[model samples]
Target: MGLNSAMATVPTKEKGSDEIDFVRWFSQLEGNLAETLNGVLLRAARPVQVGAASGAQNLASTSAGRLVGWSLREATGTAPGVVRIWDGRDNGGALLACVNLGQGASETQWMAPGGVSFQHGLYVEIITGAGLSDDVEGAVYLGGAE
Candidate 1:
């Protein structure tokens, strides 16, 4: 068999390891992905929400830590970016609970569980300026996962 065909071969040891196709595996190599894009677009909020209006911190609750396994997609054409989430609150302080987006690098992501819980608050804010200026365009997508 040719080199390419050799790598394409799959084994029958299905019980030993979780079988993943080479092409599909490469497609979702960034974390146990449920979405596209080769980077992270979601995660547990910063124990709070990062909002607009110049540093309006939305404090997170205890359950905020439960934010994991989140996934993200892309909303191309929306310049600067758009943060869409399900809003919720806890006590006097509120949290973004589930968040989909990168912190610094494009490939960085953090997610929250869906169906079982929500992203605490549905506060959608995008701050792209001097210090943190990365237009939320092209590769910008958000959704619930895990």
Candidate 2:
């Protein structure tokens, strides 16, 4: 048997021209790529306060984005409650998170490093114990898109 025939061959996919160009462009850029990306991300980050409503409140009505972080606090400082964050308009769509606050002047904060993606928007439903205020005070950090 020939030495060439005795050797094994492996197939590999070739990189496209666009990908090659992108790599070259990225390499030519000044400063750290991570730092550049971080700066862009920081500029896109936005904070919106949740309305003090007893029922559902529309936090953000954007086309596409994500929920980066959120903080909730009891308004009246009387009882415990829960804040259900939705990934759509009004109370519709998937539930992103449920933050529960303790009784008598409580607060809760949560964060998703990668962010919770949302296509429609964001909504929050506040539920409190009986004889307690349904009002809540907090803000949600929105990232991605406008």
Candidate 3:
């Protein structure tokens, strides 16, 4: 038997090319090469306040992008709860993901399997179980090309 090896190759563009040509050339590269080269990375984190009942609230108004990771913290609560993320201003939109929190003061974190992108806005909803306080707070992290 014989073993063979293959090497990756990157396409090159001529100097003095137009911006569009440069972009097109970069777009042909594999993986995140183009995004890294173009500096089109994003990372954002913001705190969220839980409502008194099951309700949706606008966590952050972001441009079109993907949510990479998130976290929730029960700053002042003793009851287990559930946190949900949405793709719109309220719970009336699509649900992106949800994280479950245990009883007592604690924090929960989650990351998208392959990153979740939203075409509209980003919202969050918090639902506490019975006998649990609603004074929960936490932060969310988002990342994308925009």
After superposing candidate 1, which stretches have Cα over 4 Å from the reference? Answer: 1-93, 97-104, 108-116, 119-121, 137-146
TM-score of each: 0.24, 0.59, 0.55
Candidate 2: stretches off by over 4 Å:
1-44, 53-57, 105-112, 128-132, 144-146
**Tens digits of per-residue lDDT for model 1, 1-146:** 42332134445665554444665555455444543235554443322324432443333222222333223322232333334333444332343333345443223344433322434533333445444433332211234222
Q: What 10-residue stretch in candidate 2 is worst by lDDT?
A: 1-10
Alpha-carbon lDDT of model 2: 0.64
Q: Estimate, for each residue in 1-146, the C-alpha lDDT of model 2 and write its tens digit.
A: 42322223344465332223444445445323322245563435566777573442455644557678877777766677678888877677888888877764555454555687888878877765675557777778776432
Model 3, TM vs. native:
0.55
Residue 11 CA displacement from its true place in model 2, Å: 43
lDDT of each: 0.36, 0.64, 0.57
What's the TM for model 1? 0.24
For residues 1-146, write the lDDT of model 3, one tens digit per residue. 53243333445476544333444445544334312424543223333344442453445544445666665656455567677788877777788887776665556564554477776777777775575545556566555333
For residue 20, give model 1's deviation from the true position in Å. Answer: 44
